[model samples]
Target: MPTPILVIDKLHIGYGHKVVIRDLSLEIREGEFVALLGASGSGKSSVLRTLAGFHSVMSGRIVLEGRDIT
Candidate 1:
């Protein structure tokens, strides 16, 4: 198997004390196309925003190219 170019492992994200996402994990390899699918307020955007560094993670790690970016 190819090494993943992007990886989100056990991610926890929230606003204040309100937890929006908990224990989210995903992996994307090179040349792989992915999508986030969910209803509104289901933490889909939260995942993307968190991956993009737009929010603070309460716990866990966000790895990119084998480096922990969280």
Candidate 2:
């Protein structure tokens, strides 16, 4: 198997004291396509925002191409 280009490990995201996402882990390999599907206010945007450096995770790590980005 190829190494993943993006890795989100044990991610915990939230706003202030309210936790919106918890223990979310994901991996995206090269040439692979993925999407986030969920209902409204289901933390989908939060995950994307977190990955784009718009939001900070409460815990865990975000690794990109063998480097820790979070």
Candidate 3:
């Protein structure tokens, strides 16, 4: 596929030793709108925090505009 607007590869996010998000990979295309939906405390905000770098990404790659973000 053509390059995505955002690409997340094998992401692992956590706080301290407590893993919140792991083994997650996704791609968002331009003009696409994606939402994080889940139960409360199920890491929806945690995922957002991970992307915004507020939370720790234990492992993974985040690509934006063909640049690696993490």
Candidate 4:
């Protein structure tokens, strides 16, 4: 949407050797007001963790403010 300020492609997240979330992708436009809404265990916080680099991405790319986080 109108160009993205942030992007996630094929993101895979896991704890240790176990993969909990996989193949996630998202795009956030500049000034976009967004919410990570879902039921419990929907990987909403997992995505945020991956973006913040707290959780290592098994395979994927994360771009934020023109910088690649992964």
Top TM-score model = 2
* lDDT of candidate 1 at residue 64, scale 0 to 100: 96
Spell out the clash pairs found in candidate 2. none
Residue ranges of candidate 4 with Cα displaced over 4 Å = none
User: By lDDT, who's the top model here?
Assistant: 2
Please, what are the lDDT tens digits per residue for candidate 4 over residues 1-70?
A: 3778998888888888888787988888987799888889888888888777787888989998788989
CA lDDT, every model vs. true structure:
0.89, 0.96, 0.84, 0.84
Regions of model 1 farther than 4 Å from truth: none
- Identify the superior model by TM-score, candidate 2 or candidate 3: 2
Q: Which portions of model 2 show Cα errors greater than 4 Å?
A: none
Give the clashing pairs for model 1: none
TM-score for each predicted model, relative to the true structure = 0.92, 0.97, 0.88, 0.83
Q: What is the lDDT ranking, best to worst?
A: 2, 1, 4, 3
TM-score of model number 4: 0.83
Tens-place lDDT per residue, model 3, 2-67, is: 669888899888878888887999999877889888888788897887678776688998888988
Clashing pairs in 3: none
